[model samples]
Target: MATVVFVHAHPDDEASQTSGSMARAASEGHRVVLVVATNGDHGDVPDDLADGETVVHRRRAEAAASNAVIGTHHVAWLDYADSGMTGWAQNDHELSFTRADTEEAAQKLAAILREEGADVVVGYDWHGGYGHPDHVKVHAVTKRAAEIAGTRRYLESSMNRSAMIRSHQAAVAAGLDVGDWDPSAPMDDGNPLGSPEEELHWACDVSEFLEVKRSALKAHASQSDARGMLEMPEEWFAQGFSWEHYIEPGRPDGMVTGWFLGEETVG
Candidate 1:
């Protein structure tokens, strides 16, 4: 069995993006490690968290609980903070992940890869899975770290350019707000706000992991709202949904999919 490391920008990202793959890998007897880059303190703050420290602690607990459901380990805060959404005006926060030194972040991720002897490293696509600054940083650092660690790197994207239009059209035809969104906007380019099929790299059938994903998502109660629920279809929730699609970076040419055993490294 090989070791796989998933580097993410925040707490809920694993659940929202790749929990199914992680769970699948673990169940298959491969070691899976989740390296979250931020403290996720910027996530929805509860009214009860009058103390900033308390908020961080609470979010950490929530993250831990969420990871438990998937049977994976969690790590975080190597040195950056969540960079919130783009153009949110708060993007320039002093502690934002965007501002973190790239080398520093890369080194932290490299350490995890080395320690875990990771055979494969997974991160976000160029758009950072929705273009969140932190997610973008995670992608950048994961690429660098995989090189530093001498491991294969995978980029997780939602859909390809073609599929994006198709999914959007379908959603729009279904009366969803597909047109009201613009992923190409400077602040929103990374996050298209709706499903785009072209963005997908390799779709994993995670129908079984959907409940686990929902449970983990629900763990962050402050962040879970009606809109978030509406964003997901009840059928998807019930029948399970495809959770992750990944793009392998450094491949010579053409698209490839499946569990990477790190054969490329054995020169």
Candidate 2:
């Protein structure tokens, strides 16, 4: 079985991006490891803080629950502070993931990759799907780490623009309330949310693992209200998330029908 590792920027990013594949990997008996880059300390601060509990502590707890739901065999962290969205003062913090030296952070992630003997490493897109500061850092670090560790495969997780357009049309036809965020809008850092569908190289049908993905999403209760992912209805969730998209840095080829590693995992 493949030792697949997914590197994400924050706690709930795994839920929003690659939880389905993580669930399916573990279920298929492949070793699955998740490396979250930050403590998510800058995430939504709820009104009710239990005495001295900090946002970092709360997010770590949520990440643990998410890990269980997604069937991740192991999880590690880069131990960096969360960098808030673009233009936020948190980006200037010395401890923020975005401010860390790329090679330095990559060395840390490469050590994890070497330790796990990772066959494949999943990371964020070039613009991190929406150009979030931490997510962008994750992309750079994961790429460098994969190279440093000589990982067999490196995939940048992304959204399919055409698929999203279809999803929006489907929601309209199905009479479901569409999400609040506009997928087409230029995000932070002034880049489009995801790569064009034509530039994508791989697509995975995670429908079988949708239930686990949903559980994983629910596990991030702190962001449930702040984020729009879990707000959608069951059917819409399936339609919107059933297919996960990816890009290959080495190859700009069009997408092929396959899972993260290959077709063998399906059987």
Candidate 3:
């Protein structure tokens, strides 16, 4: 069985971006490891909390629930504080993941890759799908980690920009209230979201895993603030999230249309 390690920026990111690929890998008996870069300390605040409970506690529990649902075999954390958004005050925080030394963070992840003998290390795309500060840091750190660990394949979890545009249009036609966010427009970092479809190397179909994906996202209950994705009805959710996209480091074209791994069914 191959070992695939997915390195993500925050607690809920794995659930949204690469959860399907990770779950599919694990279901195929490939060792799947998730390395979360931060505690998500600055994420959406959940209203209902025990007297002293913090978002950290809530998020950790949520992440654990997601880990179980995704069938991930191992989980690790860099324990850095979340770097909020592009220009938030937290961007300059000393403990923020964005402020972390790229090499130093890469060393930590590289150790895990070496320990797990990861055959594939998955990172984020160049602009991190919306250009969040910590996500960009994840891209940087994961790239260096793959190099340091000498991992053979480095697949970047990416969005198919063209596909997303079509999907958004479809959602609108279906009368789904997807909000005013125009994904095609420039993001906080002044770069457009995701890569053009032609630039994507794979579109891993996780439709069958839709239920699992929804369950995993639900695990991050504290993220109720972002209700658009979380509150979507069943059919709408399926329509919007049936496929998870990716890019192979050197390869620039072709779509997988199925699992990231080969179609050999597992027992």
Candidate 4:
């Protein structure tokens, strides 16, 4: 059983992006470790917090609940402050993950990777699925961390742009309400969502684990997006989130349907 370490930028990111894979890995008896780079201090502020409870504390508790739902074996936090969206003043904070020195942050994650004996280390794509500032930093730091730790396989978690567009078109054709979300529209850093289909390496079909994913998302109730996702139509959620995409750097272009272990389960 190989160990897979998923490095994320915030508390609920793993639930949104890689919870299925994490659940699958744990179910298969492979160790699953989650390393979050930030405390998520700048995420949505829930009004129901206890007297002295801060967003960071609440977010970390949410992450712990999420990890339980996903069957994650271990979790680590870099404890950096959240760097709010691109232009937000939080980005300039000395302790923000976005403003952290790349090498230093990488070292922190590399230590976790080494300790976990990670065979496969997962991170976000270059634009971090929507170009969020901390997410982009996660990409950079994870890349450097993987190199520093000499991990055997490095996979980048990402959405499949063409696949998303196809899913959206199908939804529209079926008269489903997709709201204002446009896959081709500019995101946080003026980049379209995720990488092109051709750029992806594999599509892990986690359809069977959809319930597990939803439960994990539900654990992060403090985040507005997570709450919104839980309220989305079940069919829509199944259609868009059943398959998680990834890019294995240096791999050839064509996409394959399989798990991250390089085993081809389906064509």
Candidate 5:
């Protein structure tokens, strides 16, 4: 079985983005490793977590639990500080992931890839999946490391514009709010088309994995509130969600799409 390593910008990003594929991969016996780029130290904290260090420690524990739920064997971090989104001003911090030397970060990730002998390395798209500076840096570093290690690389992303539009329409039909999701934003750095077509390499049917994903997201109580009851019922959540999308490396002609079969079948 191939060893697949997923590089992410924060603690819960794995759950938020790729938990289904991770679960399916591990269940199918592929060794899965989660490489979180940051400690999520800047995440929100509850009133009970008054101690600063304690909050960090708690978030780490939550991340660990989430990893376990997703069937990941290893969860390592680059141990960098979070670089809040661009234009936040705090991004100017000396130690933020955004400010970290790209070469240095790439070297560090390359070392991990070498030690793990990872066959497949997954990371966010160029837009960092949503323009988060840390996410973008993680993508850059993962890309560099994959190049250095000579391992196949993939970028995790949502559905293409048509699919996303359909999903949003479905959500709206189900009484879910679409006001917050902006479909017009540019998905990546180079693409000006805004909502350009996405090449999905693997579409993992993670409807069953949604619970695991939700639990994982719930684990990060600091950054977000997990108590929204949307129009889509829990049952719909299980059945409606069909795929975890991806963008493969070295394919510039267009978006290459497929599904993860827990093997090197090249779906």
Candidate 6:
């Protein structure tokens, strides 16, 4: 079976973006490896930490639980500190993933790709979905790593912006209490959320694994970000996350419905 490695910026990212793909890969008997660039030290601090336990430690534990829930065969951490959003002071931290040397980090991830013999590698979109500094760094680092390892199939994990807008409008029309967040609104680095519809290339239907994804999200219960998602009902979660989106750089824009190591068709 071919190996597929997913490179993510922080803990819990797999749950939000690529857990479905990972699950699909494992279910189909392909090896799935997840490499997280940072320990997520900058996420919302939970008040329930045990004495002397740090956020990094808790996040790592959560990641481990998430890995189990998603059936990931293995996981590796780059262990860099989280570089908080666009302008946060943590971005300047010496050990922050965002500030790490690109080549150095790429070399590290390349080693993993080489060791895993990855047939496909997945990273973040150009602006990292919402332009978070660490996420942007992940995109660059993973791209270079794939090049260094000579892996030709590299996909960028992203959201379908037009789909998000449609979902938002549907919620509104149904008198649902939609939050203020808008797909077209300026986010992290002043970029609108997700890649536009025409820019996307693949859509992996993970509706069957919605329960698995939700369980993975719940594994990260300590974080406020995950807590919000956990609060979402199963139907709402399915409505929003049933299909995970991706982009194969330099490929044509038609959306393909398929998994990591399977036949695909333009939809």
Number of the top candidate by TM-score? 4
Q: What lDDT would candidate 2 get against the real structure?
A: 0.87
lDDT of each residue in 1-267, candidate 4, tens digit only: 788999999999999899998998888888899999999988999989999999988999999999998999998999999999989999899999998999999999999999998888999999999999999999999999999999888989999999889988887999988789889999999999999999999899999889998999998998999998888788778987899999999888799888776444211
| lDDT by residue (tens digit), candidate 1, 141-240 | 8888888878755555444444445555676789876545444433456345323443344555666677777777777666654228536668635433
Off by more than 4 A, model 2: 169-180, 225-227, 263-267
Instruction: Look at candidate 5 and tell me the lDDT of residue 257.
Output: 49
At residue 267, give the lDDT of candidate 4. 14
**In terms of lDDT, which candidate is stronger, 1 or 2?**
2
Per-candidate TM-scores read 0.81, 0.92, 0.93, 0.96, 0.84, 0.95
Candidate 3 Cα errors over 4 Å, as ranges = 170-178, 225-227, 263-267
Tens digit of per-residue lDDT, candidate 6, span 1-267:
778899999899999888888898889888999999999988878889999999999999999999999999999999899999888899899999999999999999999999998888999999999999999999999999999999869999999999989988888899998778788899999999989888888887998888888899999998878889878886888888899999998777688776646745211
The best-first sequence of candidates by TM-score reads 4, 6, 3, 2, 5, 1
lDDT of 2 at 6: 97
lDDT of 3 by residue, 106-204 (tens): 999999999999888899988788899998898999999999999988888888889778878887998988788566899979998988988788888
Q: Write the per-residue lDDT of candidate 5 for residues 55-82, one digit (tens) a residue.
A: 5687788888888888899988899888
- Residue 34 of model 4 has an lDDT of 96
Candidate 1's displacement at residue 7, Å, is 0.8
RMSD of 6: 2.2
- Quote the positional error of residue 165 for candidate 1 in Å: 3.5
lDDT of 2 by residue, 24-64 (tens): 78887889999999999988886777999998888899899
